[model samples]
Target: MAKYLRNLTCTALFSMTLPMTAAAEESEVQDMSDPLAVYTQAGLGYTDKGINVKVGQTYDTGSDTSMGMNVLEIKGFAGEALGWNGRGADDSIDSIRFRNFTVDLTNGLGGQVDISWDFDSNQGSASYSFIQALPKMGMFNFYHSLDLG
Candidate 1:
């Protein structure tokens, strides 16, 4: 009976060891030489009374760098009221569009340019544009403008 018990213990230990060896062989990490890529997108919307606004951004990452674009649209009753009530109501009747272009250096640096335009039902419109650069640290410079028609 003691010999039989020892044989049973040896069989159980051998079975456990076999599975562990097989798992290790199957789980080895592969070598990867290609650059990694990533992509991202985001959207935001807000509404109050007759006003509605929406904004969205997207980015694409490549081998050693990345780039992105942003879009914003403003419309609805709130926009209409503000456009009409404000000094530039006539040109504000149509939708307002904004766009941003950006680049990522992949070395902890990047830059961007933004532009915007407002349209009216009567063919009148206004536009403004700006550009910015990135620094290693501290506050970066920015420029902006507004056109009331």
Candidate 2:
């Protein structure tokens, strides 16, 4: 009877050690840099009982930093004004545009501007524009950042 008990204890101990050894061998560390980790968003909103469409995409360059572009469409009593903004490692904004929906609408809007940034101080600035047709108005454009650490 004692010999059988000893054999059972040995078997249980051996089984437990096997799983620990396997887990240690399977452990690994991976890099967080992935260009395909981009994010996208699209939605629709009501403007004085009309429909307003919005779409945007953001790309992360790793190290808690990212860039993005946004396109908005406003349709209602008002026409529409489409705009775009982008950011980089230094948190600087550039290449802004605004235009009228009825005039040369195909080319969209075009403009050039620069945003101030402080890398060491971790601060930046953003801007916005809008278009109005009546009781309905379309305004879009902004920049924001956060610190994960």
Candidate 3:
């Protein structure tokens, strides 16, 4: 009985000393350095840091021109505007927006027109829309991107 007990103790100690691996709260395909919220450690919609901001500007005052936006995707947007005399009724918009657009296909083929309305102007506060009849093309090609590592 004594010899059997000794062997059992030794076996238990050896098993405890053997190396073991534990799976973290991560996966093999997930990236640890990626900043996107999809695979982030803090979970979706959680901002680890205070804030991140980016700005861009384009100005061209040549002639009255219009551009057609075929496909536009706005992944993110953050803006700041000024108010009129700090009154809620007189608040105004002086802000910037971030949007990505693919308009090469409809650039010269489609004529562009922009129309706006405002309470500050002769026209009262309202909205406008421009409709277009596009010609169909038989051949269509889709653009895509792939990341393989």
Worst 10 residues of 2 by lDDT: 77-86
The lDDT, on a scale of 0 to 1, for candidate 2 is: 0.29
In candidate 3, which residue pairs clash?
none
Error of 2 at 65 (Å): 4.7
Instruction: Write one digit per residue (lDDT tens) for candidate 1, span 25-49.
Output: 4354422211111122222322222
TM-scores, each model vs. reference = 0.37, 0.23, 0.18
Superposition error at 43 for model 2 (Å) = 1.1
- In candidate 1 the C-alpha lDDT for residue 143 amounts to 29
Candidate with better lDDT, 1 vs 3: 1
Candidate 3 TM-score over all chains jointly: 0.18
lDDT of 2 by residue, 49-108 (tens): 223344434333343332333333333211121111111122222222222111112222
Model 1 C-alpha RMSD vs. true structure (Å) is: 23.6
Q: What lDDT tens digits, residue by residue, belong to model 3 across residues 1-149?
A: 67456545543443232222233366555322211112211111101111122322222223335322221111111111111122332223222223222122332222222222333343422222323323434654232322121
For model 1, where is the 10-residue window of minimal lDDT?
A: 31-40
RMSD of each: 23.6, 26.6, 24.2
Q: Point to the candidate with the largest lDDT.
A: 1
Clashing residue pairs in all predictions, respectively, total: 2, 0, 0
To one decimal, what is the Cα RMSD in angstroms of model 2 from the true structure? 26.6
